[model samples]
Every structure is written in structure tokens, then in C-alpha cells.
Target: NVYYADFDKILLEVCVGKNRLKTERTDIYTNIRHFGRTTKKGYSFKAVIPVDKINGRDKIYFEYTYGEAKVRTSITFLSFQSRLSNKLPESYWIFGNSILSYDEKKKQMIVEPLTFGSHLKHEIKMMYRVARHGRKRIGKKKTLEMLRLRASIKLNRGFGRKDNDSISGAPKNKKPVWITYDQLFKGGDNGQYFYEYMNKNVSDIETCYIINKDTKEYKELTRKYDRKTVLPFSTYKTRLKCLKSDMLFATRIDIRLYMGFTENDEIYVRDLFKADVVCLQHGLTIQKIAQYQNKFYDNTKHYFCVSPKEVENITKPIYGYTNDMITLTGAPRYDGLVGEPKKQILITPTWRRNVTAGTNEKGKQHEYSVNFKRTTYYQIYNSLINDKRLIAAAKKTGYRIVYLVHPILSPQADDFDKNDFVDIVPGVKANYEKMLKESALMVTDYSGIQFDFAYMRRPLVYFHPAELPPQYAEEDTGFGPICRTNDELIDELIKAMQSDCRLEDSYKDNINNFFPYDDQSACKRVYEAALKITNFS
Candidate 1:
């Protein structure tokens, strides 16, 4: 169970091949081989799964093994080629742009992307007129229906349908991929509210994080990165190109995402809204608004803000905003805070804002580096490296730090090379459970993790570094224990380390409209939300 995720979100592999030489075909499974683990006589070939699997300390045990007289997992790199090509259909891609048809006789389906854009791309009247007067060449309604249905299937885990049976025959090992936006530490009322909203609205007790692509990895120049992350699959143009190529060996695509970002500007979202339901984790951040410059959103509808209590004190009522709409649903994560917390302290630092670990020297910035601007990361890093009192206090008090870097930061830094001070990590969803299980001491600067950390009723410490950017003008600093110095901060931290200030009459009853489920039903909440979105069926 890996808590901190790296650039590769997941690494999963499946093994598929016939038992006899008569079934000698080799390109049986998808994904390129990474490494071969074991071998038994000559009965089987052990192929490394293609996706990254995150369990670090505990290796995943398949629990059971299939027919095996021998295993052949070892392979030479000089020539590592998977030849499961002949039996499968080429190009399993079914996207916004693809020509498709089902061949009932052969029980095969063919998809050709780029030959035609999506039927929805045309005006409704033009599309209808084209459909009525001319030959149906292939689709408009049928293709869109299937694509939407595929997304729905992935969302509800196929809701009682036999996903294994395709127009073509069932392949051996096939699993659908489910992905969603991560909102644990996005901060502001939106992030907190959405965190709780997801916990209460979504189901399946799952958590997945996707790192930005700009963060790259390099094997050359010691500290240098090549264009590998961007070269093969970077932009949408490149992604489409790669898809056209991935088509050669693909069997079928279970589901593809427009991904976690729920921008109304997206062609897919705009098309789906009339007939589809959507659940979002965070409302628009200030950066997003500035980036869009009033052009990114449509005035017709607004994003539903689920975590309102987190921002109610500072933000005005957002439920009825005009240009950009927001619904105040109250987050599901904070439901536990309804009465009072046994103890609570949240220490989370903001991610790099203007500067990063490695960057070109043109004074250019990623712009998304919010934390980098408010607090100097390298300085805090130095403080953590040199401070003995802080370290000793953490150790003596049986304190455990819940370090959550920006999800976008991992791609820029290596998990193998991440700071070594972090201690104790339970599985994913259980991170909040970990906070509930252990000490409540939070020490952070400018990071949104502090917002939820406040939801806990324990001591809080804010590390406002000297390097904070002046451009970020805001008067509503969070109300709790705050600090500016090293030694002085430690004493304050020690004082608040074991306190319960969340139950005070001042805030217990005054609730914001944002957060939806403060109780432990976050998973159920999320599952229900997914159901609502998928009811388009």
C-alpha cells in the first residue's frame, strides 16, 4: 500500500497464453515486459505486467497460481518483443473521433479514428439533416451511445452487464480501469468541501492520484531529464497519434477518460451534461479563473461547491453566483467534526508555486506552484534538516507527521529521492483514519492540507516562511495556532499538541454549506454520486 504516489499512477500486468506449443502465439497479453521474476521448468513464460503497482513494503501476492509445470519469467533485453498480435483486433480505440461498425457475422467490431470527427461536433440541426437525407455511413447516435455507455460501465463496474463478452470473443485477463480526481489537500473551501463530498457521495473506498506530465524523469546527465515523458505521449495531438499506433496490438479498450478535470469547456463534458451526470471534487481555483480569463466557463451553469464550511467565514454565499455557478453541498470528510474531535492538528505544506526543484533559467515558472510562492520549500527543507528540537519533540511526543506534498510535485521529484524524514504511512483512504488513530499535531505553511487539519480539534502550527510571495493578497489567514519562528514555534506546537479546540461553542454549531459528509460514509457518498452521474443509462 503506497501512500505517496510517483509519476506513474499504477503499474499492473496480466499474463495470458496457451499451455501448449500448438498455442505457440506469444503476443498474448498487453503491456511491455519490465522484468521477469521467476521460472518453472519450461511450461510457462513469466511476463512482467505493464503498469506500475504501488505496494512498496508488501509485495502483492496473487494468492493462487494457475497450471504450472514450469515458469519462464526471465528474458533478455537485447530482444524483448511481445507477439500476441495475430489473434487480437487492431486499434481498439473508440474516442470522440472514430468510425465504427459491428460485424454480426464475424462477431468483430472495427474502429477507425481520425477518418471522421465526432458526430456531436456538428450542429444538432446539421447532424440531423445529414442523418435524414443521406446514407448513415456509420454513426452519430450509435457511436456516441456506445462511448457514453462505456464510460457508464467503467463508473458502475458494469452495473450487471457481462463486460467480458465483447462483439468479439472474451479475452483471458481483462480488467476495467477506474480513475478520478484527487482532492485530499487542495485547500480552500472547495477542496475541503469536495474532499468530504467525495467521501460522502462516491463509493468503493478507493483513492487514486494522477501526477502532471510536465514533471519528467531522466536517466542521463545525473540530474538531467530527457523528453521521454513528452515524446511518445504528451499533448492531445501526440496522444491521438500514439492511440493510432497502440491500435496495432490492442484487443479492445474498456474505458477511456476525458480524465478528472471537469471543465465545461471540454467537448465531452458539454455533450454529456444534457444526458450525463457529473461529480466534481474541487471547484475552480483562483489560478484556473485567471487562466481562463472569463472565456473558459459558460454562464449557463456553474460548478457545484461541496465543501462550504471550510470557506464560509471568508467567502460569501456562492450558491447563487451568476457568471460562475457553485452549489454549496458541505463536504463529506468533515461530517466527523459535527460534534467535536478527540484531538486534531493538520500540518501540510503547499507545493512549489513559482519555482521548482529543477527548471530552465529563463525566470519562467510553472504558475501552478502555489506553495513555492507562499513558503520557501528549500528553506523549510533546510529547517527540517537542521532542527534538532523540532525532531526531538516529534519523537518524544510519539508524534507522526502526515506529509502530503502537492500531487503535481511527485512527477518533478522522485519517490526514490523524496525527502527521507516522512514516517508512517497506512494505505490510501486510511490516511484520514491514520490521523484519527494517532497524535494530532499539525505543522505547516500555506498548504491547503491545513484546512482539513483544522477540521481536527488539536494544536495547529503554521510555518510562514520569509520567502512568501507578496502578490497573493488575502486577509483571511485561517483561525488557529500560527507560527513564524523556529524555536518559538516549537514551544507553541508543544502547547497545542494535545489540545481539543474544535469543540468550542464558537464553531460547533456554525456550519458552512460546503462539506456534505463529515461522517465515515465518504465512500458511500462517492459511490452514490457516481450512480447519479451514470443514471444517464
Candidate 2:
């Protein structure tokens, strides 16, 4: 509703993986073709392909094109970039759609979205090309279906709905959902806190608390993926248990605010069967790249689109769901960071190696050469773990040092030692609310940490290690300085930590536009939407 924005037309540019066509007719058109599975009439959103000619080879495309005859795409690469700005809400900007491209007729090349990667250009182009027909139809909706199919497989493999006798033993409460995270260890792994918090936060509402499933012994979160433990990965058996669960509490409607997650995780599919299922993903650029992997749920009840900004112009094209589907509820994990963002500083470097694609038993796949600048948990940890300067400040200034390790590096305590100066807190399953409540400041690079920190409106010092390859930058982007060495880390961390009330002065304007957590009613907005969708009262 702003005057200037109303007149500001979205800028449409066309650029791509080596313009295969003549420089002339490369105009990026808003007109687009929908890529539906089966007979192909199904197209979620449209996009203006900014390219010469979508060759049959390349996997992705970007920028803009030239010409009137230039494929007038509705929600193509051009439109998404034109409307969305950086720093959109993490939950709103979801990376979706994994199929290469639907032949608009043949029906084939159905694949899952690449939930954990940073090759947007590569994903987009390949998705468009491989989807040329009769190959394997992978649409956003299909990815979701794939999840259900996985669960169905689980049913066949044994993990089915709780037996009638088991249901009869229910604790007077028909709570139909079950969740288990290996990370939470508050009450000596007994999961006593579940009852405590459930009672306090959601008590006497006919609920059952049973976490730390294997707490009879000491099994730390991330100890090792055990099917016998809590919830395992999206395996065949896991799916069945998830599917047969009562639809009312099928899943938590996981609205991931940060980046990186399986497009077809069991939880996502479980939500599909439930009446009130919804997913909150972030990023226009991220979502489009992930398009190929998630085309399955292109037209499902549970599937929805919710990114940081709603990026208005582009999101409207693909996400047909109402604004309710797009709750601006920042993120439950980030709820504590709003308004009271810290003035002090804490360092949280990015963690890589653990999440490598080809990383197998032998070790992380070291062959593939990435195209961006990236730093790993091992590298960053070693570089600054014993840094004399960092230690001195933590001890002297009481800088409140906490290392927020990515999920991959979390369980492996054998790799690094956590001393008095450093506390290794895994980003996964680790309650971010606790981190935000205790700390006054945070420092992180890439990895969805920025989005979580931004909600707090705290001063974040981005440490850009020069040792990392430039291609890593494609992994993530947020405003701040780049620290290349231990010395730079000290200076930045010191300044950020020492400052008492400089956050509002230094990061005020940017935080306002980026996070905008000024109001605490985001949860209310999200809750109401969920109520209307499921009529849950």
C-alpha cells in the first residue's frame, strides 16, 4: 500500500546458463506455460523465462530474455527474482517444485525437490529440460505424493496404524500424533519436560507426553539413527506408522523457517492425510530451484506456499492458496528473538562437510567442486577453537560464547571438545527459544542461522573465511561484514559483544525491513489460519 511501491513495476531481467540462442529475442516474458503432470495441462504458477531458447540440455535458467515472441511465461525465473527482495521471512519463502519440466503432454520425469542444495540455476534449468515428457513426471505435488507412497511402502513393510488393542490403551486422551527428537535432553533424557511443558503450555487438553523414547538408557540426541529410537528418517516402516496415525494429529505441519530439509520428509506426507496440514517454507529463489523435487504435491490439500515476503508478484503466480496459507508467523523457533534482540555478541560459524551429498560411510564426498564460498563445521571449529584471542575475551569479557553447530556435526562430540569458553549447541532439535532467551547477541554465516538471529534484531557479525571457495556465497546471503581470519573474528566478536545498545542504532533500519517482528501477534495470525483451514476451533 505504499505510494512509491505501488508505482514501482517489478523489474524483469533475463539471464541464464550460457545464452544458447542469439542475443536478440531474449526478452523475458511474463507469459508462461504451466508444467502439470499426466497430460501436462497442470501448471502451478507461471514464470517468464529470461533466455534465448530453453535448450534440451541445461538443467536451469536465470536472468532475463529479449523479444515479444519470447515465451510469455507467468511464474518463471524472471518474475520470482523481480519481485522478491533479500531477507524475506524464512518460513514464508519455501523452496518447492522438483520436476525438471512437464512436456505439457507426455507425463514423465517426476522427481523430488532438492531440499538441501544451493544450485538454484542448475536445479531450475535441469528441471525444465528433463521434464520434456514421458521421461518421469516430477511436479511439486508429485514430490508430496512420493512421501505418501513411501509411507504406503512402510505400511506394506509393517509399521502400520497402532493396532486396535494399542489404541484401546490410549491414556484417556486420543492424541493421535507422536514425535521424537534425539536432541532435546533437558530432564536427563527422560522426556519429563514434555509433560512439564505440555502441561504448562498445552495442558489437560487430552494430550500424551512421551519423548526420549529410548531414555531408559543414555542416548543423546543425534547419537545415531536407530529405527528403534524415536522418529527415524522417511524409511518404509516409518511412513506406515505416520500414515495410520489419526488424521487430526497426523503431523505437526512442519513450517520450516530455515533452509534445507527433505522435500518428501515423512512429516510432510503425514500432513497430507490430515485435514489441517500445512508447510511453511521460505525463499522465492530457493523455492523455484527446489521446484523439480516437489512437483508431486502440486495440487494437494496439505501442500502450500509460504515464503519470507510472499514476494507478492511471483508467489501469487504459483501459490494458489489464500493469504491464510501464508501466515507471517516469523517462526516459532524465532519467537523469542523478537523485540529483545541482544546487544552483546556470540559467534556461530556455518557448518558444511556433515551435509555433503555424497558423504557416505567412508567420508564426505570430496570430489564435486562447488561453485560458491562455503565453510565447514570442521574447518571453522579448528580454525578458532583454540584461538588465544577468542579464549581470552570469552574468559575476560564474559562474552557469552555459544557455538550453534549445524545438525550434521551435532552428535559427533568425538570431533571437537567443548570447554568452559565454548558450548556446542546443535541447531537441530535444539530449542532456539532457549538460545535466544539466554543470549544477548549472535554471530553466524550462511546456513539459516541468520533468519533466526534476525528475528531477535541482534547484532550479527558475518565471518567470511577467505579460505572458503567463492562458490560458497551462493549458499546464503545476509547483510554484514565478512571476517577472513581469527584476528578479524576477534575484532568483530569483541565489538559486537561489547556494545550495549548499538543494535538498534546499527541494525535498526535493516532489521525493521527484513524481520519486522515488531508485533507479537504472528502466532495469532498463524493459529487463526490453521483453525479456519481445519475448523479446529
Candidate 3:
């Protein structure tokens, strides 16, 4: 049902059309019903417009007629084939490093929310959308139509097989190298750093990054670098490049999940030609609290080593990988870590699994509220942020704290009170890295960024409330003072500032143990490795 504001007397009629052809098509729709009443602000109604089929058109148009005024809108239809097609853009949230695991009991993927706010927001929205859909005509038929559409499309595509028969051919550029990050493309990660290094330093190797189309990152990349250096992720050109490329560098193999391609698709393509793959990991793997397993490590030829411990852990007997697959080339993302330290604190916390809220089955809007303030995270952080002791300590130390909320909590920035004492900074992924570079100290609870800060030889303080969710145990953090209460955190901060923010002796030892190289030659090492990997082909 459509709503009109402050309606007096208006004769309105709604009609459906196929493309530009307008008519009251009886075959396309059936049992049209309307239910609503007039309110002070407007006249609202629910018109149950159920369409049996789209009849092969890309979209159906709706015409709203009201007294010499005609408004138009169109609803696009997706056959199941189109749903899994490479034409659609992937969802943005998955790249935030949230884990999705298949639950056998529930028969659905368990999604953990990124922050307290997202957890609450999802819960609220799920309920609201479920109830709203019950009262709408579009609600009931939508799920059935979607399933039917999917089935119809799958039948046409020969079901669960590659549609790349048209793409089969010999290599276009035999020596081409391909690069990409996870589906969610961000800035200044290992992927971009590697691409930049290859373009400026390495020679005689054609390189291109797999980028999503119509994305701001894509536009920015094209504006900053050569437009021809990027290939659209889901297009024929990308598949051709992947098939023919001699070497592949990527942050993750999760692109398959995003593109609706299976492991078998990759295997089928791999059978044609062996493309040596190098994995430049996006972040340091914290095994204890890591939600997702390294499922793709076995598939790759080389894995970039961020630390000695990472290499050791991944090559354990259970992981089934040997040292032969490990390359001690440090992550390219860490090559340019130069910055003058400022009196600032960066707070980056890990996400939680228990706090995740699932959406309704029919995919309707949900409206509900979770007491975000009462959450364990809020209870601990809010106390420290608003505490007079911390404020006084901050003033004495001449330092300001910036709460770099996780990307998942992006929408819930308002959940915290904005004031001079604490700044809740949440914006672009690129800016987050920039902030890290400028910070003198980092306060976090089990985030991989700890490794990055430690690499800079800066002081770090870990504040974990006992009541909050369990991250990795305290022992897992080899260096850094662990503070459970606000008072402890304040005392630690003041002491660290008085010492001129030098990283402790233990931290130095840990840094040395983790990173074998601190000479800023990571990109060089990576390029040399790439040359060795491609020499055979």
C-alpha cells in the first residue's frame, strides 16, 4: 500500500505494466487487495499486489494514477540464476572479518555481529520486519516467488556447474600476474601495497588488481593509478585473467563465497593451468580467539609470514602444512610504518559471537531495541570514558583518547556520549590505518592491531573488564599491561606517559620473536619471492 500525505479527495488507481507497455494485465497479477485507514498525517493502505510471474522481463513497472498526476516506479526481478550471477555486487559486511560457520542443527550460517550496537540493531530490525511483513501483501508471496525464480534459473544453468564454456581458451598474456583482496576492498592493505610495489619497483611482469565495479575504492584506485591496472571482480575479463595468469596474490580466497562460486569452480579452472598463489594475509592470526579456521591455506602455494610464531602455528601437524610452503617475507602493509608519535590512544576491540542477532526468515524489516548501554562492552568502556579519574589522568599526561570503534559498530557511534574527554572516531578503513600510524599508545582487547602497534615500538595497555565477554586469555598477550578496572587503566596510562611512552622490555622481546625483520625490506622480499615463483612459467 502506498501512503499519501494530507490527502483530501483523490481518485487513485494502480496498474502494472510490462516494460513500457501499460495495462491492467490480468495474467501477471491476481487477487489484488487493499487494507488501510486515514490518519492525521496521511492516508495509508496495504495493497496486496501478488504477481504470479514476471514473464521473462527484466522488471515490471508500476503506475500510480491520481487526478492528472501519474508517478512511476519499477521492481526488478531476480531469477535464482541471477542471484548467484557475477553481475551483482557482494555485501560489504562480510569483509569486516566476522566469522560465518554452518550450523548443522539450525541449518543456517551463524553470523556474529561486529559491535554491541550492530547486535542490538539486528535484533530490533529482525522483529520489526517480521511483524511488518505479516501485514503486507508483498510479504507473503516474496519468499515463494524468490524460491521459484531460483529454481527456474538453476534449471537453465545446468545446476551447480561452471558457465565458463564460452570463456575456455588459451592464455591471453602468459606471464600476467593477478592481485586482489577480500571481496570488501579497502585501502593500504597488503594487496594494495604489493600492487604498488610491483608497479613501481618490479619490471617485466604484467599486474592487475581484481576490483568490484561502481565502488568508491575502484574509482579511487582508477583515479590514483592506471585504469587498465584493475579488472572487475565478476566479469568475463576477470575470469579470463584468473585462468591465464601465471601468479596470483590475494589476501583471502573468500572471494569464492562472495561471487557465488564453489571450490569446485576454482579446482576446475586450476586443472587447466597451475597458477602459483601467494597469500599476503590481511592481519596477524590470533589463534585462541580466531573465529574462522584457515581453510584455504592448504590450497595456496605460498603463505606470507608476518611473524615466526604465525609460521610455526600454521605449519603444525594438525594444519597439514610444511615449512616449504612458508615464505618469511614480512607483510607488505608494514613496510611504511613511519610517523611521529602523538599523545593519543587508539581503542580497537574484537567482535563477539554471542551478541549476533539473526534476521527473520522472510527478510522483512525488524524493529526492536537492545539496551546497548547495558551491554558488557558499554559497561566497561563507558566507565573508563566518562570517569573523572581517567579525565584527570588524561589532563595530567597531556593525552587525549580516541575510541576507534570497530567498523561493525559504525552505525552506533551515537551510543557513546561525544565529549572532550573521549572521541568516538569511526570512519573509513583507510582513516583507521592512518590513525594507527599517528597514535603514541593503543588500548585494545584482543585485536590484531596490537601487533602493528608493537611493531612501532609504542606503549600499549590492554583493558579488559572481567564482566565482558572472554577474548583470548591474558597470557596470550605476551607484552603490555592488562588493566581490568578504570582505576588500573588510568594508573597504567599515567605511568606509561611519564616514561615517555617507550615500549616495555618484554614488548621488545615479543616484537623480535614475532617479526624476524624490522628493516622495512618486506616489499623487496615479497617481490623477490614473486620472481622465483614465476620463473618456471
Q: Highest lDDT among the candidates is held by which one? A: 3
Off by over 4 Å in 2: 1-212, 215-276, 281-289, 292-324, 336-345, 353-377, 417-420, 425-431, 469-479, 484-486, 504-506, 519-523
Writing each residue's lDDT as its tens digit, candidate 1 over 33-152 gives 234322221121233422132211212111112233222222211110111111112212222233232333343333333222332222233334334432342256533432443344
The model with the greater TM-score, 1 or 2, is 2
Q: After superposition, how far is residue 340 of candidate 2 from its true place, in Å?
A: 7.7
Task: Compose the digit string of candidate 2's lDDT tens values, residues 1-537.
Answer: 112221122233333334432222211222223453222222122345442344333333222223332332323211211211111111011112221332222211112232324223433332343233213435555454444453453333232222332211111114434222212222221122222232335422322222333343224332432323233333443344433332221112231100112432222222223222244332222323323213222222332222355334223434343443344544433333444443234555555653343343211212332421143645566557657777776667666567765554544433555676776665444555566655676666565556565655555666667655432325333445667766887787666555552565546566676654554444344444544554335
In terms of lDDT, the poorest run of 10 residues in model 1 is 246-255
Candidate 1: count the clashes.
Answer: 53
Greater TM-score among 2 and 3 belongs to 3
The global C-alpha lDDT for each of the candidates, from Candidate 1 onward, is 0.33, 0.38, 0.54
TM-score per model over all chains: 0.41, 0.48, 0.62
Sorting all predicted structures by TM-score, with the top scorer first, yields 3, 2, 1
Arrange candidates by lDDT, highest first: which order? 3, 2, 1
Q: Show where candidate 1 strays beyond 4 Å.
A: 1-180, 183-257, 260-279, 283-302, 306-326, 332-346, 357-375, 411-439, 470-478, 498-537
